[model samples]
Target: MQGHTPTPVFSVRDKRNLLFIILGLVPAAALAFWLHILPVFQGLYLSLFRWSGLSPKRKFVGLANFRALANDSLVWKALGHDVYMVVFRLTAVIVLALLFAGILHFSSRRKQKIVQGLFFFPNVLSVAVVGIIFTFIYNPSIGALNAILTNLGLENLTQAWLGNPKTAFPAVLFPTVWGAVGYQMLLLFAGMSSIPKAYTEVALLEGATRIQEFFQVTLPLLRNVVKTCVSLVVINTLNRTFIFIRVMTKGGPNDATEVLGNYMFYQGFENFKFGYATSIAVINFTLALVLTFVVTRLLKKENLEYA
Candidate 1:
């Protein structure tokens, strides 16, 4: 055994495989650090200071931004708007997507693809485009919505949807739900397709109605997929509603449509309160992370087993 190296716990081949795996992951890890992780840390660091982000002047005012945000009424109201959107979007999208997914799941293969495409078409357009299109539709002077109402002799129902605080947020929610439901529907449909037909057939054989089977069998089995969809919707509603709101309302009509993301943008770019905006961004990110974690844990389930 003289001059011999001890046998490694991992054989050469195993070590080679491990090396390859590490190499494969290195690029992705580096890219993530450069793109996502680095900016997050930068934002957090910037949040502790007062900076206009237009000059080299960065006054280190630790936690002042956070304190300011805590006392700011608009921040709280904006977050409340986000919560409202999360709740409304979660309810409307899930219900409608699930309903449509169920219908698509049971339809003929050819017809299902066509209908699914039609539903998903909206998702293909940029969010700004959808917002702009809806803006025209809601234009009181000559918008399609009011024009159609007038033609139908329902002129009393017409209002400047985006200009009225009472209707602005709800009108915004309509397009938000419409644009999102299709993708979630397709996700749920795929989940439904993965379930064994035997489970459904067995339920039917036992004289279970379709509704009973869905509730007792399909929905229970689709829990994991539904959980994913819920988390996605929550995160998107919290972090990505800015574009739609910006294009449509600009958080206007007395700030009734203000949400966290839009508020962050308004402060950072419009008001030159970059530090305050970064703090809001931090809060937005935290809220999304916490809510997603809470939702996932709430929906945690044991894996389904089949004999």
Candidate 2:
């Protein structure tokens, strides 16, 4: 009798609920595969060949393209530039956005709204337009940047920002970081806004300075948000680097600004090396996947008690 308590069983209602859940997931899973997973497989398959744009023969070279890519010095150089961008862009966006978000989050509602909109305005425009505008802004002759520098008696600092190999990479990256700040700031600000007001009040009651409260209380609570922002920045920079480089520098200034995206385009379309280009795509996708996984593991959240 003591052992007679029957194990809980899935009732008819429970089974019906499970059935509905499975039904709902079917289309979503199918869509994900069709849209995202299928393309990756297709690209990987295409990368193993030696096909020009017109060739129906589809000569299978079997990893030759990847082998060539390994030996390609230009590819390595482009990758090095991308790695540099990852560090610089993340640093500029995160630090600047965090500082501005703190300012806005603590400001009055009207002031915060006006300034936040101004900050995020750049994101609403097409990237091409922003690039075009900045191209003019960086123009050495009549550009606003040089004009301001000249007027400030820093004429020595004014140079061909986009044409000089030493300055071209940073020139291209500056626009990216500038446009990204608003979005990242807004994201971090939202996370800050969500922090329980009681926590701040308690910290203040304990005679903590504003800086102490921020470091100990606000930032700790926003750890997950910061991680998410970093991940998004990584993804956005990787994808958008092609467009920025193409429109602004076209990987010029002696290829100082070459990155994966534009370089892949040049190989596939301009050079008509489709197979080689797809190999580059495979590398790009793999690099992105690996970085995202590592970042997720590194930023893994703990069971912090928050009420």
Candidate 3:
């Protein structure tokens, strides 16, 4: 047999293009490493030790924190709340956003602009402001919700929305959905708009009903956008629930509204269990990664392009 030289894996032009693409991504990659990737690794390292956040004394008790997490009842409770929040918030927000987006897509331009502005206005407000507003609305006495109920002769239907243990978790979710719906709606609307009109026209011409057209045509084409929205919601549900829990309920009524983020903060900052807190953080990050992967996989499909 004669010896042969190996062929290049990439052509010269392909190599050049790869280099340019990498150079273009350098800033983003650097930023993501610094802000996201580095912190995750740091957290993993810290989870294996015992230390208060500020103390000089550090002890390596490998896997001890994770063991503690396994036995902690609060961890399971908070995780349950997180699951509930993710399921309900994801469903409500996506459904409402899609509904409004469909309506907006079909409306006149003037009506579309007005409805979009109204829907998206809540996103302009800070989370703290929205939480506070909801808190006042849910107050046991003199809350807008109660007042409305009383005026409508439904006084018996009124109760402390954020105060009662039974209602606190669900109550916290409403504001989150309210604030999120507009942004998601706009995203879906843009997806809808980018779809060529010819597709809808063809569907209609083929005797497809509007509902059938939406299910078979519009939604299938919007898969990528919907996937992005789903991924965003999952990440936010894991990471961003802290502010809502802190401001709205503070995981109150005997930790009834507790989520992983809230409990992690309580452990690290309030109780100074940095190692244990980081363990919770590790769990959170893992769950987020897994959920994102699931969403991406579920929504994976061939890209549809308009001619």
Candidate 4:
């Protein structure tokens, strides 16, 4: 009988606390929706119409813009450039970063910190700044690269790096790798540091050489970290538009180095075709998302038990 007393449902204090929590979050939620979500929706809507962005008129064309993009040769070419970026820039960044991280990880503590700091310095600068610096470095007449080649008697190798279509994409790719390597190095270094010293020590005791230990122990354990780094690099390489377009070549020499980002920018801003640009943006976003998901899933299958 005493246990039969019913507990009160819906306590007044609990309800008041819930109400206060909702009220407190309302402003932040509103701001996010207005600034981010609303704009995304607006962009999607705009993609369904034909608009010049500045004109006073907009004509609804349904999926025609997307269809047009599918047939646009330039879009495919830009996408190919994006693929090249992933292959060259992203791959170089990951390789150099991991190599540097490995070297720093095996060094003394003091040396490790110094090397880490030096490697990560490039990441501190804005992308635009990095582009500008590299632009000067690749300048045909006075750039450091050309200057070095000239001094080394490799004059035949020296040309207007950014001006020639043959070298323009690779020229931009080098700077992208230089700017990005530092950040990825730091991430890999942190991951490597988290690995227990006992594993390597045991490997050494078993008469395993340092190279053998790296492949047998360190790399296997760092698989997850490698996956994360790869995903990030891919996304960055795909989404990056401004730095390449702004610094070296703006899809110059007959759209040779044009990537999706630059293509979208040209369509929307330069050509004033808002609808077409929105379609490109949507496609680019979709590509990035798909690549991220696919790579993450593939890596997850080979995930190592770091713990």
Candidate 5:
């Protein structure tokens, strides 16, 4: 008799487990596509029309909104403010966070936890709350900052922090840096902690000073984390809203503090120019995408392993 053909082994349990995971993920994937991705595409489509947000009629404008944005001086000004935020506010936050992370990495575990919590405390509060708090802190007449300045005999240096055009942008940016530095610090600290202790110990044995070890070894290994922190801060600064501008200035003192996000809001909700607002949204999204891609690509080219 011919040898019986061997039956292939099939594991029902493995098949069932795989099917269950796929089934569980389907709803989440669908929800994400519907809620986040669809609105972006819809905004892109709507940007080619001229329609107030509540208008029943929509005229096919064919890039008129984009053309208008190109010619609008206010748009340029708002873009400048956004760039300032990235350059000034975001840079300060990242640098401060890195410094704090380095200090914490060298501390005892208990002290490290306490310091980390203190740094991150601001991030736990809602943006609105932080905005309100800072608003009071910067109040021209009664704010804590000005009060302290007056008591310290620096009355000449004190001015309407959030009301004056000269100080408004920096005043608004201060709280943003305060609120975000902790999150970035934690990320950097985690990255620094993961570096092999043997490397540092060897360097110390060779009589390398703390500053020398930091510059030669710690900074290089922390490069990937630094890149990530910079990217996060840049994106956050670009998209910041509902905090500094909302509570402290409201893009006031003649729009001195207006960033792209607030500009888009004013166009859509305040001005009722839905199509134009959508166009602005598209531009902001495009800018963010381009910046993120360029930064990530440059980091990768430098052989910084983010993971």
Candidate 6:
């Protein structure tokens, strides 16, 4: 007893397991702190100060930047545009993806794989690349779209799609919709695949058509997946507006297509209003957080169990 240690409560294996668990958590904790947590706090701090991102001194301007943002009609308009874009994106992504996913669900296994790959192809590319490709497609004079319109004798329909403020928002949004729908379809199909076919069979046996079966049985079973897709769509609509807007229109035809992300970029890098930009970033983050919270709560379930 004098020289030997007392009996340990945990065996060597338990202690070793605990050590491994702690070791596993250390890297993740460090990454979360460094990559996400610290940056958010730093952005908040910088938002209260005027720094061009180059100056040695950061002049503390208090809430002036945020106040300016609040008063700016353009900023408000940009916020409105963000909402509009999200609404459109959310609707289009869901309707199209869900429809196609349903179709793919019933397809033969071989055909399903081929068509699914085609649908998912767009999602694999970077948003900027898609934007660039679509930019060419929308070109009025020699673009493929205009050529098709001309060939079909619908020349009036083809204009400078990205140049006219009236057409710019929809034009830019088209590519985004094209790129986003596929991934959501994939998710929905995956969810559908997990569903037990017995439910569908039972519904069918009870005089349920394919449509009826989908509505009564499939949709209910896929609730969690649908909820998840909705959340992802909301999030994507918020944050993923950046690369598309930047590459395609650059928040142009006279700010008609301006969304929060590009507007923030225009403020920070182009205008050198880093403080103002940081304020925009803060507001963007806050709005995204609030919306994401609402979505999660709205989709929250008592239990996923279906027996």
The prediction achieving the highest lDDT against the true structure is 1
lDDT of 2 by residue, 178-226 (tens): 7889999999999999889999889989999888888889988888898
Clashes of each: 0, 0, 0, 0, 0, 0
* Ten-residue region with minimum lDDT total, candidate 5: 4-13
Score each candidate by Cα lDDT.
0.90, 0.87, 0.89, 0.84, 0.82, 0.87
Worst 10 residues of 6 by lDDT: 4-13
C-alpha lDDT of candidate 1 relative to the true structure: 0.90
Candidate 2 regions with alpha-carbon error over 4 angstroms: 1-37, 301-307
Cα lDDT tens digits, model 5, 1-307, are 2475433343335676568777888899999999988987889999999999686899999989999999988888888887677778656887898889888877899999899888899999988889889888989878999999999999998988888999988888888888999999999989898888888778888999987888788888788888888788777776765346866687888888887788888899899999999888888777777777776676664554424
Please state the error at residue 230 of candidate 1 in Å: 0.3
TM-score for each predicted model, relative to the true structure: 0.89, 0.87, 0.87, 0.90, 0.89, 0.88
**Local error of candidate 2 at residue 183 (angstroms):** 1.0
172 Cα displacement, candidate 5 (Å): 0.3
RMSD of 4: 4.2
Model 6 accuracy (lDDT, Cα): 0.87
Candidate 6: where are CA atoms >4 Å away?
1-32, 296-304
RMSD of 5: 4.9
For residues 158-273, what per-residue lDDT tens digits would candidate 1 score against the true structure?
Answer: 99999999999999888989899999999999999999999999999999999899989999899989999999999899877778999999998999999889999999999998
- Ten residues in sequence with the least summed lDDT for candidate 1: 4-13
Q: Write the per-residue lDDT of candidate 6 for residues 1-307, one digit (tens) a residue.
A: 3676545643335677678768898899999999989988988998999888887888999999899999998889888898788778878998899999999988999988998889889999988789989999999877898899999999888899999999999999998999888899999999998888887899999999999898878987888888789889888888887679999989999999988899889989999888899899888877777776876787676645565
Best by TM-score: 4
Writing each residue's lDDT as its tens digit, candidate 3 over 1-307 gives 2385334554335677678778889989999999989987899999999999788998999999999999999999988888788888889999999999988877899999999999999988999999999999999887999999999999998999988899888889999999999999999999999999999989999999988999899998898899989889989988996688899888998899998899989999999999999999998888889877986897797887664
